[model samples]
Target: MNPNVTVINPTITEDKESKIRVAAYCRVSTNSEDQQNSLITQMRYYENFLSDSETERLVSVYADEGITGTQMDKREEFQRMLKDCRRGKIDRIIVKSISRFARNTKDCLSVLRELKELGISVMFEKENIDTANITDEIMVTVMGGLAQEESASISNNVRWGIRSKMKNGTVKFHSAPLGYDLYEGNLIINKREAEIVKSIYKMFLSGMGYDSICRELNESKVIKNDKGTKWLSASVRYILTNEKYIGDSLWQKNYNTSMPYRKVRNKGELEKYYINNTHEAIITREEFEKVQELIEQRKHPNMNLINNYPLSKKIYCGKCGSLFKRRFKNEKSYWICREHYYNAENCRTKPILEQVFYTAFMTMYNKLKANYSVIFTPMLTQLQELKNKKYGSNKQYIEINKEIAQLKEQTHVLARLKTKGFLDVSKYIEQVTEINAKIEKLNRELRKIVRCDDEDEMIEQIKEIASIIENGTDLMTEFDDVMFESLIEKIIVKNQTEFEFNLIGGLKFTENSIDNCT
Candidate 1:
């Protein structure tokens, strides 16, 4: 909740005179602390926006932080003003824009209806939208829908663009694992770190299981990935299986077309693109081929190695017991028996949708929720640790270290070039952008450090979600698609009676006997 600002009720000395007791309201949806400037700018602009209001005015500023425009009920400031309006305290609300007011049609109408009943007016500056005029509601309803669609389109385009880049091998994982460093601006081949990669590869090749390799890496006192911690088998397998090392990019492995929150994986249904040969290779083609062969065999070259895709390895046709490779057709995703697609009589069942299986599995979502509630806690703890330690690291300290290193290296190169007379002062100044980039990164990282409270804000989101769910029954009679999607992933229709559903996070699933279990 933002600070509750009170507007000093203006002097009504003259019976016929109208007075303006005005205040401003501003909002920015991003959780970024950098948006502080933007919010301030908007508030100040609104203060000026109502400067010449000649009517009876009682304006006060109400703000919501990192809040969505899709809904109005979650906004504490907006709701507070509504309460004030109900008590006949406020006369007008000054918003910066319609999008600031709402992106959802239903929310825009509901709030405007509330204010209309209270005879309170809302003025939006961007589209010159005013709630007082009854016609403005119609315009807002149409425009807000367009705005929401535009936002969704941009999100889809961005996801596609990212997948394309990944396919082209231009976009690699942001963090190179501990064993290798990204070199040549585009290639990852850290000599010191590469040794660890080689060690891991060797262990996998020699048949040492991933868990054993993790233990070995820890026991060897080797530095873990950028995240300072012990290695785990899952992480090891992820690295081992990543095709990035061999220079082939599998693009479009995931996509985020779903809305409200556009994360590719959390959504039960996401599309992925697979592109090949994106960058300089770290492992030889022969080595990559060998690894793939070993992967197919489900054998680790070392005694300590193990394969995680054991089931995938033995995915044979139910009828012929031949390999039933996964395949897709048209725009629909499915897994048909290869023999059937090739020779219809050779297969048992027809080509079935992978998503159908997923949906069937998800029919058990309600039963799974209880189990998820338990697993969510520990999973959240471990995930946060990994995100902070690996992705974030001692982010500030590491950023400074990088800047100092860049400055020293670039400056030394400039000195050498000067001594050899191969580069002039002008050339040195013009070509020092890498060093400048480092400085800029340093500044960004420094500014970010001041807003460590971001974590707290994220944690508090649980309460906000709970509040929404509590009010959901009253808000709408029907089920909310977004909330259900946010909680559940795909349900696997493993068989007619044995479908399995998965949750968004590492939530554990507890299966109960379904009414129509196969």
Candidate 2:
């Protein structure tokens, strides 16, 4: 038997002689020329490496450019390669390194386990490790951890550099805002966009809410962000609150957290820099501050009310002092007291036709236009005199400003204490809340004083109202929604037929509704 021990080779069948379908994945975290070149070289190397092997067939060379490896979901090509592997179109994957494949340890191990389960293998050329030949994942795990740490280090360095630039007031504006263009790291106001920005601020100041402004823009087909995107209330609010329009730059209003990163509002979590006169002004500081105040005042817990119809939250039942809610009957809109709408027995107020309010507004506004010289002109002069009288050396104003500054400084101190673990979370929150309350109170007082200082704004508003009326069509044949929002503050149902219109500047008028207008 030992003499007859001749080796017999096993028959290799044609069905088992299929070539291994190999795929390569390459990625560059940035779009720089050097990284692009590296990516191309990696793709070429994989293609040549597989082409030289008779048993391996090149399936694809997947490449992701200008994307982060920390998040696997963001890498399109990497995901595609995995999909191909699951589809049995790939038997092996070749990557330059673990970091190139994924800088996240968990994502790396998860994908590796999935590939191994599918009878597929992954080769890390730089690490000289193959998922199929590995007895355990300890080496891969350690390598993945190193890659993750490296990514974290790189992120920290980039953040530090950006923060350094922010501190030195030398940070480049990456993209120009709606009204400006970035040229040589400077923001230059685009003339046409600047006009739109100004109009937004003006509209807000004129009592046109965010929804109204958005509607006006969209209905007029105003282009935004150089795209024909539809206007949104958020877009209007951003323009209203952004300091960039006021010739100032505020950096670090938002910041990104460490690995497993998230973008969050700064909210005292980090230091912010404010540099004034960074560019040409599209809106004055005073106008911006006033808009901020209006925004705060208009904030309602019920967001639906913020963008409701023109009469929403503006009509009230004079008898029960309940808010009027919009209702529909027979395909017509009516404003009924909330109490009456829910339980008719609770309130006796009748539902008023929505058109009545519109007609009332037109009538009231026309009257104001006719009596502009008699009513608004004298009132404007008085406001101007009062404004001039309080123009210099306001001790109360100075004291309030000082108090606000001190309170703000205290907040910074509290933030630092919390960061240093000197204050417990609950206690820190309590103290900050108290400090904010005090600051808000002082700010309210300051705003009152500021309002007095803003008689010029009121005078300008009065002039605008007069101009709209003066330029309006004779007798106002149609109900102007814009005029209604601009002039009237609220409407009160005095009775079934009588409605009282409260104007913005504390003026009131009564009008009788036309019978069966609805």
Q: Best by TM-score, which number?
A: 2
lDDT, residue 300, model 1: 26
Lowest summed lDDT across 10 adjacent residues in model 2 is found at 299-308
Q: Count clashes in each candidate, considering only residues at least 3 apart in sequence or on different chains.
A: 37, 0
lDDT of 1 by residue, 36-80 (tens): 557656655555556666664435556666665445677766776
Pairs with backbone N, CA or C atoms under 3 Å apart (clashes), candidate 2: none
Tens-place lDDT per residue, model 2, 151-252, is 889888878998999888888787798989889778998999999999999998887886678779979878774223356555676788899998999999
- Candidate 1 runs further than 4 Å off: 1-123, 131-144, 159-191, 225-229, 265-277, 299-518
- Global lDDT scores for all candidate models: 0.56, 0.77
Error of 2 at 495 (Å): 23
